[model samples]
Target: MSRQVQINKIVGRLVAKKREAVSLTQEDVAGRLNLNTESYGRIERGVTPLTVSRLVKLATLFQCGIDELVLETSTGLTGQAQYIANMLDGVSSSDRDEIVKIVEKICALSHKKHLKSIKPY
Candidate 1:
């Protein structure tokens, strides 16, 4: 696939995942975006190219940042990291710190659990 097509597919998957995360159906999102179900489905499937204005609207509707919708860096974070960054867009520094600490703790606990599940060599 072309680079743009790949990016579009990635963005579409991200949007679809976020929508599902918030318990929204494709029909529901279509209505919210003033699009027909077929057109919206195309967007979700990356058959249609997304415009900046539409992207901004999606970001607002999804409660995420535009960067999360568009930025894809090979050397930097993408996917869930981008989503988390978007979520932190308007958060205060202290709140961000607290969230980071909580995430770290969760990761540590998950790592411990994973280690426990491993059989000895």
Candidate 2:
């Protein structure tokens, strides 16, 4: 497949997964987007090219980042970090500071647990 086609397929799969994760049916998503069920199905199956506006709408509907829908190679913590960054993009500085503090605390706790689990030489 061509590069764009491959990317579409990857994005389609990710979108479908996200939709399912939120317990939304294809018909439900179609209704929300004002699209026909078959047309939305094609987009989910990567048979149709998903338009940029539609993609943005899907991201908004799914409460996720556009990069989560578009970037095929990002996965695991990398993808999650990107998604979190996207969510933080428009937040106030105080909100961002609070979120950073929470994340730092979580990381520090995780690091402590990891260190305890390791048998020191």
Per-model root-mean-square deviation over C-alphas: 5.3, 3.9
- Candidates' lDDT values, in order? 0.83, 0.88
- Please provide TM-scores, in order, for all candidate models, with all chains considered together: 0.64, 0.64
Q: Report the C-alpha lDDT of model 1 over 32-112, residue by residue, as the tens digit.
A: 889999999998888898888889888888876676566653454556776677668899999999999999999999999
Q: What is the clash count for each candidate, in the order shown?
A: 0, 0
Q: Candidate 2, overall lDDT? A: 0.88
What's the lDDT of the predicted structure labeled candidate 1?
Answer: 0.83
Tens-digit per-residue lDDT, 1-121, candidate 2: 8987887788889899989988999999999999999999989888888889999999899987787787764569887787787778889999999999999999999999999999989
Cα-based lDDT at residue 90, candidate 1: 90
Candidate 2: RMSD to truth:
3.9
| Best lDDT among the predictions, by candidate number | 2
Record all residue pairs in model 1 with backbone atoms less than 3 Å apart, i.e. clashing: none
